[model samples]
Target: MTSGPQHPTPDTHACSAHPADPSMAPAPDAERCAHGQAFEILSTCHEHIGERLGALEEVGRALRDAPELEQQHLATLGEVLAFLDTAIPIHSADEEQSLFPRLRALPTFAGAVGDTPMDCMEAEHIEHGDEKARLKAAIVTRDAGAVGRHAIALANAYRSHIAKEEEVLYPMARQLLTDPAAIADMTEEMRARRREAGLLKC
Candidate 1:
């Protein structure tokens, strides 16, 4: 096994103030991946997801505080929805196909990580899809109460989900995927999946 970079501290991901423009939020600091570069990519994607969640929470707050909806609020809702529609399914594929399979193949990881956690994660992805549909319907109907409820639910769900990946999943990926060749294979497969999904340049 190749000795690679150490796992980062959890505090490295402190949440910043919600940005006025959700699309313009600064990305997570890119890390050098001595082993699996896919972990680095996944971490950065999590940061983007976190920013969107923050924006979702802000929208929920606005809907609660005001009696009438405004154009700006609707625009922000649309912007966030557009991003979630595009980015999330691809991110899920990155984990379900590329990351989890490799991790589960390792004997040490197989027993420790087991099927339960991964099964739960996949189930949560399905839950997210259901929630996204409800959120879109609420936005279309211009129902502030429903929108606020769904936004808060989505944000809370992802915040918890991402926390588990950062704290447990990514750290274990860094530790177990120590072969340079294995890491390279994982990286290539992840990139290929993204390109096939039209999420990245081929």
Candidate 2:
């Protein structure tokens, strides 16, 4: 495991004044992963995810109270939605594509029984996706109750999922994945993903 900043600096200006339209609101700070530190990057991503989940929960509470999307709530919703759409997928890819497969190939994990930790994490990822879809649909239909319910559900699920990864999965990976070449490859792949998404300079 590598040591670095655990959380990105939030762009306070983005939400300084609520926009008239939620879609017009600026996005949250873009989380950046340091080169050649794949596990650190993943951990940083978890921090960002936690922040977004907090924002989502706040949105849920606001909606529950008013049952109408206020400007501030919409601004927060936009940030949360954008994170779900973009950052979450990339983070998932970092785990599923880069880290999980490497761990699975290791002898310690190769002979594991049915439904490994990786399986559970992937399954939870799918569940989170489903919940996000429901939340988005509710937002589109202006269903305040449904939006609040789904947002809170998604936030809770993601928080638990993050905990499992941080506590069990990440430490396991750090212990097992000690190959320098493998770490380099994972770092390159992650950087490539960001470059392709136009989030990183080549």
Candidate 3:
């Protein structure tokens, strides 16, 4: 029998061309049969989020070091704003459009009605988007109040964003992605979008 690990596969595909996760523990047979793809995707998402959080931390440090805005600090602020503007939206959209819909399809997320992860995530995107705009303007206009407010907005949002995604969204998405068809669709959708956005190769 071809074991999962030893299963025949293509040479050019990613390590996940079959199914695997670096962060999650090995799934038991039943759970593996159900949520394997979700587990892998969740692991990758967490890594993505963690990396972004680290960059955001630098923004916080800059703010702390220079309580009074300085022109030199605009460079750091520019990096933070640009990252938030680009990266967060794509990640959030992947979860909302590709991942969360699959979750909401499952009976496990029936109670998730009205407050699906996608809906919550979309709201936060809009909220953070406003903060990003303010942060950019703070740099351009040299407005201390705007800088403080934008930094505070991102710091506050990161607190809740990481918590909710880790505690709520990851598990839920994992549960829903059990369906092979669902995972396959999500993989294709994400790959296409990423390629279009120049975030990935075809």
Ranking by lDDT: 2, 1, 3
* Each prediction's TM-score versus the true structure: 0.77, 0.80, 0.66
True-structure RMSD, every candidate: 6.9, 11.1, 11.5
Off by over 4 Å in 3: 1-46, 64-68, 108-113
- Per-residue lDDT for 42-151 in model 3, tens only? 44544554555555555656665465777566666666566556656666667777876776666555665765556666677678677767667776776666676677
**Top lDDT hit:** 2
| TM-score quality measure for candidate 3 | 0.66
Task: Compute the lDDT for candidate 1.
Answer: 0.70
Clashing pairs in 2: none
What is the Cα root-mean-square deviation between model 2 and the actual structure? 11.1
How many residue pairs clash (N, CA or C atoms closer than 3 angstroms) in each of the candidate models, in the order given? 0, 0, 0
lDDT of 2 by residue, 32-107 (tens): 4645378877777777677778789888987786767667877888888887788888989999999988877765
